[model samples]
Target: MTVFDLPARLDATNAPAIEQQLLRLIQTDKPALLVCNFAATDYISSAGLRILLLAAKTLRQQGAELQLRQMQPAVADVFRLAGLHGVLNIQN
Candidate 1:
């Protein structure tokens, strides 16, 4: 498993760069599990959600898993509001 600590804010400004980095990690390392720690993330915009979904899809295609953990309530709520909580693996 590979654990990635996310930034405090996930918005359009940085989502693209983060997406590239995440994709690179998935393609190069190909870990069985990729854990994205959202302990420090207080906000997640739609762009951020898109990145997560894309990463999850890429991992799924490779037969791996994407696990999101330690999310702040606000960030978690964003996922819930987007109806993504059921689609992704999220842990307290």
Candidate 2:
């Protein structure tokens, strides 16, 4: 299991950096479970959501999984609004 502590703001500005990090993880021989801790994240833009979805897709292709945990209310709402709860594993 590998975990990433997401920042407080996940917008277009920082989404790419996060994406690179996740991509590196995917390229490595890591565990199947990748956890993103969003305890500090209160906002996430569409770009951020896209990154998450991309990460999830890549992990799935690698026979792995992605788990998002401790999401703030606002961030969680964004995910819900995007109807991504069905595609991603989110834990309140």
Candidate 3:
């Protein structure tokens, strides 16, 4: 299992870094657990959710897993509203 420290802001400005990190994590040979912390972020835009959705897809392909933990409510709402709560496993 590996932990990922999400940026303070994960909007349009950080999309590239997020995508790169997601790819890097997927390259691992073993099944992985990616714990993402979004507490530093007050809110996330659709762009941020887009990145997470992509990461979830990658994790599925690799037979690994990704989770959102230590997330603030404002940000969690992003996932909920997107109907992603059932898709992404979140732990707090």
lDDT, residue 36, candidate 3:
77
Report the C-alpha lDDT of model 2 over 40-83, residue by residue, as the tens digit. Answer: 99899999999999999998888999999999888889998999
Off by over 4 Å in 1: none
Order candidates by TM-score, high to low: 1, 2, 3
Question: How much does candidate 3 score in TM-score?
Answer: 0.87
Kindly list the per-residue Cα lDDT of model 3 for residues 27-74, writing each as its tens digit. Answer: 754447777777687778788888888887888877878888999887
lDDT score of residue 31 within candidate 3: 47
What stretches of model 3 exceed 4 Å from their correct place?
28-31
Comparison by lDDT, 1 against 3, better one:
1
Pairs with steric clashes in candidate 2: none
Root-mean-square deviation (CA) per prediction: 0.4, 0.9, 1.6
Q: TM-score for every candidate vs. truth?
A: 0.98, 0.95, 0.87
Per-candidate local distance difference test: 0.95, 0.90, 0.81
lDDT of 1 by residue, 1-92 (tens): 99988999999999999999999999999999999999999999999999999999999999999999999998989999999989999999
